[model samples]
Target: MPCQSSEELNVLVKEAREFTKDGKVADYIPALGRANPHDLSIAIQYPDGQCISAGDIERKMSLQSISKVISLALVLMDRGPSYVFDRVGMEPTGDPFNSIAKLETSSPAKPLNPMINAGALVVTHMIKGNSIDERFQRLLSFIRELGNDATIQYSEEVAKSEFNTAYLNRSLSYFLKQHHIIQEDVEELIDLYTRQCAIEMNCLELARIGLIFAMDGVDPDSGKQIIPVHIARICKTFMVTCGMYNASGEFAIKIGIPAKSGVSGGIMGAVPGKFGIGIFGPALDEKGNSIAGIKLLELLSKNYQLSMF
Candidate 1:
């Protein structure tokens, strides 16, 4: 209800679009580099099933790091919190999302948190499955349920691109393997992880998934709990603490919501029992967040007093 109409949201999107010029699209992975730096989009899904949008909300993009939060939720459901937390810490790191410096120095050699590459790799490894195919299918099925879209699938081109260039992630996996944090084959884990990151969807679908989290993991349409309330709380806590990479603190202070962003310029925000927001702005700031998307969030949070704080 805070954003009453698409016309109002479009005004904010237009204003925030100006900041896209200040950012650059991520090109480390060859496929991700092809995004139009100026493109921006947003969608909001209310619990009552009403949705409002601005820009190209149907354009599909990879999930990138946003998949980490979903994977974490699935793993927690699979292995339970005690087992998952025993291997990965709950703290946030000031370092970059892929940094392994802390992994080398941590007393027990565990990653600082699940949002980082090291920790995500560990979490993915913990997903319950008998084989890589079976494991990936399980994760994929969960994603489809969250989006409420049966057609949702991973981008083979993007997945291949990421898999080929995932040297840092491979190194992190090996390090975790050496410490016995992840006992699986490095290549297998990387394959699954890259595919996980490459799962693609448009803004509206992303918004629907965010709505589930906003409603404490309940599917508003079905009245079913996809994720338990306690687990939803844990996932939202991480989104507040580490979801925006190292920029999480500033984002929390500015936007004051549980949101997760990805290098693909996708942001999924849960406004806590109100509505879910999804944004995609491929032009990334220096910290790898969607430049215009964050600006739009700032505008929305301020104009509507949407901040939970």
Candidate 2:
């Protein structure tokens, strides 16, 4: 039943690409706009070390919002979930990824979930470091470990592009500061957050990260515990509830997997006890998930009955 065969996956990926017409590339970041919106690819790896890939398989893109998954785990491992959750909440905001409106409205003013910009800024402030550079370096180091590859690092060009025009994220940081959720320099945290988002990797590397979660914090291939089991469970829960931005509920209802999607049009999915799936489809739906990627996952989950639900 494993469709790791290249021919089977190639046909499936081609079929999924038709859905790309329903979405658009995230040009608001300008640098991300350069992604060939027409590009669509997928990679799925199971715990046994088998892999399935189709189309643009080697293409690299920034982690974008998907970096939040690592940041949340790092904070939980560093300060414990009790401390981290006190600063942020576990619930989904049901608002847009960058919605500042949620700040003024939510009680106690904690960013709803770490997946959103406001919440991610709060976690970035909590990362231990003497300077912005130190913090991001630590984060990048952790991310590289998750990917199980030393060569992965932040995309300097993408970081510069996002930092120069990150007006919305800047606003979110100031709002968190005002709410007392972030007690540090706004610009420093913003720089850390922006650079973290620019960490670049391809689908194969992403599958490694996802497999760590699927294996409950242990790297299935290496047998090393990358994070604590409890922390990994919390992250997986957030992915099920908030990973796809506002469309999280729909994604869960359909795909029923713990996954995270970035504005750069990359999605990382962990199928518990089964496989780690990585997808890149630059065209995104209204809620910011990859259009073709979501469709492909739907096809996979349905045909293979991979949904957890």
Candidate 3:
């Protein structure tokens, strides 16, 4: 496949930036509300190591729910798929990211999948460590290893803010406890989950991590296996089925790639050995996906033939 020239990518970035005008920054999280709605950036890394980026590709942002994929992968690696699956199901719920309706009605009360807030909280509890700091450090290490960036760290402001306002997540954690789903203390697990979501990185760093998924859990540039092949497959499957909150199906139809979006207006997309795309636009649509980021991915997928489907 021919690589896109920097000039061509720049033009596409400019076109995608227009979408931010139609969307608004996520205001529910006060920390996230401070982002510039018009901020948009993109970075693409090819299997052979070619890199192209446009706009504010270096601007840092919180990982938000995007960290769920990594947390799921880490838990699967530490405790096999059977153990992880026993705690969280793989089915997608067509509801919002934090919906608890299913928990009240679903027979087993397990979370539908790890992409949603409830499911991610369960996965975070499953992470192996003695203390919250230890678990968070382990998670940060895994992300840095996959991204080949050693500077990734948790944003204190984001973590503290989320910790203070995570009422829905707290309710979900307690509900999971009532059902014997969560094995850890509810407060501890919620803190762990919130900290994971607060991990920060830019599009370039995120693109590197996405490339590992594109290469089936192996770091393409270094040929190091960071995540197991089976776990990688499972993660990609969930990304396709439930990564975009309730809009996962629509994103699959339009973008046709395994991807995940964060409330902080970041997206990580894997194209299975072809390319990895990272996009950021703080403004989001009703479903909590970055509007401009989604547009950029759709255009890039069509133009580059990067869809996994």
Candidate 2 lDDT over 236-293, as tens digits, reads: 9999999999999999999899999998999999999788988899999988889999
Off by over 4 Å in 3: 1-5
Residue-by-residue lDDT tens digits, candidate 3, 1-309:
323447877888789889889899978888999999999888888778888888878899999999999999999999999998888989998999999999998889999899988899989998888899999999999998987788888899898899889999999999999999987887888788888999999988888888888788988877788888989999999999999899998888888899999999999998876777788899999999999899988888799776766
TM-score of each: 0.98, 0.97, 0.97
Q: Kindly provide the TM-score of model 3 when superposed on the true structure, using C-alpha atoms.
A: 0.97
The collision pairs in model 3 are none
| Candidate 1 residue-wise lDDT, 1-309, digit = tens | 333349988999999999999999999999999999999999999988889999989899999999999999999999899999999999999999999999999989999999999999999999999999899999999999999999999999999999999999999999999999999899999999999999999999899999999999999999999999999989999999999999999999999999999999999999999999999999999888999999999999999888888
Ranking by lDDT: 1, 3, 2
lDDT of 1 at 253: 98
Whole-model lDDT, candidate 2? Answer: 0.88
Least lDDT summed over 10 consecutive residues: which range in candidate 1? Answer: 1-10
| Lowest summed lDDT window (length 10), candidate 2 | 1-10
Structure candidate 1, residue pairs in collision: none
Which number leads on lDDT?
A: 1
